[model samples]
Target: MKKLLHFLFHSEVPDINERYRKVTSAFVVIFIIGYSIGFLQLLHLGPYLGPGLGDNVSFQPLITSLQALHSQNPSLWYALIALLCVTVSFRLLVMLAGYFLFEREEGSAYPIKWIIVFFLCNLFSTLTIPLLLFALATLFWVSGLDFNLGWQWIDHNVRLANQLVVNHVPTLINAPAPIAVLMIAIISGFFHYWFHRLGHTQRILWLLFHRPHHMTPALMQSTTMAVFTALPLFFFIILPYNLIFGACTKLFSSEPLYTEVIIFNCLILIPEIFGHHTALYQIASRNQLIRLASFISGGGVYHYMHHSSEPEHCGRSGAVNLVNIGGGPLFIWDIVFGTYCPLSAKTPRAGLSGQPELHMNPIRLTLAGLAQICNELYRNPSWREKWRIVIGSSSYTPTLSTDFAIKSNKIRQEQATPNPATIKNFTFSAPADAIASVAAKPVTGPQS
Candidate 1:
């Protein structure tokens, strides 16, 4: 038990400052990308919805809700605004906290790199999601099938989901909505824990999407770049339960689901943000929840092990690698596969830089992305190194390990030496034959 506890908490002192910059950068990047996609989607509705109501008719309720904000109660409006702001602000604070305690930079206390990372990843994923959804929606629309968007659909799904949960786990229905949500949350958290563990331990999977994510070992606010995966997993599994719980409350005279859902969702964001950011926040001191969530697999600890930099001691073992150790709330899938890496077991070897190596080659990039997706889905990454000459770089360094420092120093020393034959005088403007003539007649006395 003691050893188990130590393994869970042990972390190499992280460079929080560097991580802060990363987190901030990623946030900004994703934000821009999100808005940009939104803008493009808005453009598509230019002919149909107009500027004021771009695509509004397609999703009236969501649009109406947005439009209603102007006349809504000040408290309600503020709450919604605060909610969105919290998404960004809370995450930034997590990074900032780490920066203050553990990070160091040359001139600034806060690392600007985090800000850049935020924008970069935000742009990439945000744009990607909307475009993806739009493409899918368009495909369906063009197929002559009209999709309905309304509260009724939400209500129906919620009710159905509630029934499913109750049927499978009766204890959930008996508990208070928050308690029920908590139970679901616990299960969903563990699912994340295992998914992440597998993402690391299974090399084939790591090479694809997960590899690009690990591009920066140091924190970049873009750490939240994986939110798409994180949020959807919970939404599909736990959220419907909450929605159903809320619906049942209305039918059975129970508390509103909004309060609990909002609180739980908002709270869940903290770990989501902090877990991915550099380990700067001491929230770990009171991290019972994190420990519980991570212990199961996809939780913070499970993901953290995936983030470790030590060679041999790093990577996942398909068995017991925390992130994707199992396919359950805890780790049932991993147990089935015999790849479960328990927290108490020796730390699994960190997988190869499962991250896709970004290169300028068009074919390589496409292949890399495809490779990553396959790895993530099937857990069979066939990683191959492709060497290319870097024009201006003095040398290429393979993997950012401690040996890189030594290798860099050696490169500098090698560059310092000049060939004896190529001394400055050897390059005189006088003809090449002049050097031969001068050498032949070099015995002349210095005295005039």
Candidate 2:
């Protein structure tokens, strides 16, 4: 017992507790095992305030319509398969190419695990999130708010922009095929730039919806880093782009523009997909043809900077996705907004910083940002301050603690004391010392 105590408390070796490691590993294994079995039926969150709180709130109708939409459209499958070939299958090939082309830098995670993490999280989200949205829409529908019109607002804007282009530059409408595609790209890139920027720059959007994409620890794990993120990234992102763009193209044009579909896909999604892969970006940066095509837009390099873990790359201090906020033709927007960074400026190492918990559990990860918000709200007692925690910046933290004045953070920093809550992880004597130290510390602040 005495030797054990000495080893734990005074041994030069830092990792002295094999039992602790085993315990933690057990927890992790259990977490994964339990969650894996339960994610299908056990993963649901809604039907929230039903029958008693609000009668006849059913998600079945919404769920069924989604199922029908897939079963209903055979063409959707073709489009999906084609998209998968280019994006997902393409990504796997890129990884292999990187393995052969350049020696992977030391410490690069193989990304197989992270890739699986992406797919699993994506599957869970695909099954759950849309239903949640549909249910919310159903509620709004019951409340008599026109949610469909809100989404259609984007379509209306697209039409308005098209009309403006047609009226102002008549030749642009009838331009050669290449020129017409460029126009469509620019217009699409422009609208998407503003919308995409909102996901990153806006407080509510970033914290609740977009931060997980930035939380990815490595991008090379096929650069698909979470678009199951920001439903993270990759297949879901590209598929929708191809699907919606194809549909819209068919809607506008006289015939199917299969060539245009592929072109537009490459242009818009390169940043979202290729940009996240280190080896791919390395290759893309060197290939003049690729460079020339993506020159005017925020391509691989622009997005590489956004996912960079470097403090400056985070753009707004603690927030990320601020640097090189948009892709494709929106490089101009990034520059105008001062969010642009050049690939040549510095070689960026992608993935998240200081947030390993984001990768731990897929289910928790999606709502972790929300959980963090709830934690903050719990800490803050003032309703006004709580409101700010929700609506204000994610980095925002209330400076005050109830009616009492405290200088707790500074005092703890100076004292270098351990938290009482973490005492269970250490020796009994250490915890006693921690308690004494905490008790001895002064709580200084302005008088309330």
Candidate 3:
């Protein structure tokens, strides 16, 4: 176990030249896994097991119409694929633009290899892992265990709320599909803001999951996805929003919420991609207008500022200033909560303060982060902690400190400088006894 921890936490940094190959391999592996999951979903090989698993009875007409459209016109599939391709291509182009336009110092600029690695890391952490977890949760549900752990109670309440709205509220039930979709998006975004905020302020969550992203020495476009966290924690991080979305869908509309979700996600991605940009691009004439847009959409310079390693931007524990700018698609939450940091504030240093120059490789870094969480759990035996871990509690004691960094720096500086004080304090003693004094006396005759 010790050896494993050492391997996970103490792996040597890879050479710059080798990083590209390593990163590419990681991407390929995650892509294959993600693709397989998607393929299974499309084939309906996996049972759709959840609260709303077979609740499409009210949307049979819409489902039939979609099925008929698919049966009549195969070209629609091709068109949809083309549209997805175009959207992805545009996002990639924007990332490239940010990379080139940003003026990064030679030392600080991310190498092509590192950028690829970071991008793939983010992809796996954000998309692939969450998808896998959702699938697993569904599988668990099919086996008759409510795999939701901490979320089951919340899910039950949400379902009840949905039932009330759908069966009781005639106006909401009759609302237009677009309005329903918009409401879902806004509600989901609001929850996401809180989830992110809680992740930072909560000690155990931050140490196990959130700290890795902040540990990076520099920020690049790919840094947006570089969340180093336990896989289980990743599942918990995303579960609330998914549950809330499902509830809203069941409550508000008969149409399949999947399409709406895709659209909302794509729209949200626009700001997210730009927010991760290294260069600041002024989007409007007035700063207030820009802030307002960011507040509404949950993107822009404020998000970038959240990544700042400076104490002011982030708390002493390295969490982003929760009092300001921790929203998702809406910054209004931050404003209301009094955590709204403006973009006009001076750009703060990015990454963890006093971060080590030499760090573990990406894969090891991830494993190490998880290992730390397990170790913490083992040390503290409490049902509450276990429940929190299972249900994704966003509270814990803050433990990360600058003491190690300060001590390491002090040692390095001491090693670099000779201890003149010690040398100056050195003194030679002579025996006071006549025989010892004669032996210790200087040989004056010989010197002469």
Candidate 4:
């Protein structure tokens, strides 16, 4: 048990615990800040009523006015504030914080700085979200007239997904929380994995959207990091189902059930952060039972395989279908289709062939920061860039050529081994204590 705990919390690498601690602290701080912001908006105070000891039925105009003053839905104000904070101030704060907390030197974590970069990129990305919502609204207005302009198509799909999650799946499974979570994990995981892979397999998708995600080989602590590039891939394909399914979930489920869904979403996002980030962490399966659970639950090292660079690691071309390639949290469809990769005790890149450079140097990084600001300022919107939806159908076959596969493999490999030397040379920041600590106490490196 002690050994197990050591691997999970410590590993051979020094400061792993410290890094996790910092991240947790950051999350706590952010959550508290968010709550404070929410509180200041005074949206929590709803219609209040007081009962008199004898005449409880008596209503007073003054009391009503006071209650109205105390209680108002600040949804619009909250949204506006979130827009300003997340889009504008968040990045600036992160940059300043990163520089303050992290070092700019070699082998140090510029996590703080990276956090800023992620937020700014994400803030810029949010601009498209409002546009997406408006486009959908306009399409809905047009579809009301029976004029088909591709808006109703998503609405139709959302309805279908709504039926699947709210009605069909519920009836099929008796258990609510566990079953709902598992089912969602499976279905949504499949969609996430496939859609994510699809974004890589198809070059057009890669060029149009995904490259931005890969553009930064690592991740930072910013809501923008979560929302920005993720929005493109998420909404571009899954928004219809997501929006409709969410509505159906709320409509069909009671408060308790809704709470379960929220909990499950949080659980999923934690692993998601781990999977998407450049940080390589693994949940080593202890025994066969645990391994079996990992394949179904997908909390194991399976996702790291998708990020693998070796020819053997991801050589199956036709297997590019997301549903078939199961990544941790249960999507039984992958197993039924024989695509599930069992949990391994080893780290993801262990024994895998190929290396890729994913990180950028200070100069390029600075340029990226500048370009992000510029694009936010003056980038033009086009019809294709606007209101784009990705649906898999008989009409559109997402093409995946062999050369494309090779190139993707190479990119993943390169991303694994960013030129830290180059990055450090151009970097003018202090070195991270985590890296310094690790360097001071050198342990045997992972058997890559």
RMSD of each: 23.6, 18.0, 19.6, 17.7
**lDDT of model number 1:** 0.36
Give the lowest summed-lDDT range of ten residues in model 1.
46-55
Error of 2 at 323 (Å): 2.0
What candidate 2 gets wrong by more than 4 Å, as runs, is 1-92, 98-103, 107-116, 130-177, 221-259, 266-272, 279-281, 286-289, 312-320, 344-346, 353-359, 399-448
Q: Which candidate has the top score in lDDT? A: 3
Write down the TM-score of every candidate: 0.43, 0.52, 0.57, 0.43
lDDT of 2 by residue, 215-260 (tens): 5555543224244334322222333333333332332333323334
In model 3, state the lDDT of residue 133.
Answer: 54
Model 2, position 409, has a per-residue lDDT of: 32
Between prediction 1 and prediction 3, the one with superior TM-score is 3
- Please, what is the whole-model Cα lDDT of each candidate in the order they appear? 0.36, 0.44, 0.46, 0.36
Q: Look at candidate 2 and tell me the lDDT of residue 341.
A: 45
Task: Report how far residue 398 has shifted in candidate 4, in Å.
Answer: 15
Clash count of each predicted structure: 69, 10, 8, 20
Q: List the residue pairs that clash in candidate 2.
A: 226-229, 226-232, 226-233, 227-231, 227-232, 227-233, 228-231, 228-232, 228-233, 229-232
Which tens-of-lDDT digit does each residue in 263-318 have in candidate 1? 44444444454444444423441355554544332334344444433322322221
Off by over 4 Å in 4: 1-106, 111-115, 132-170, 173-177, 187-193, 221-240, 243-256, 263-273, 276-296, 300-305, 308-448
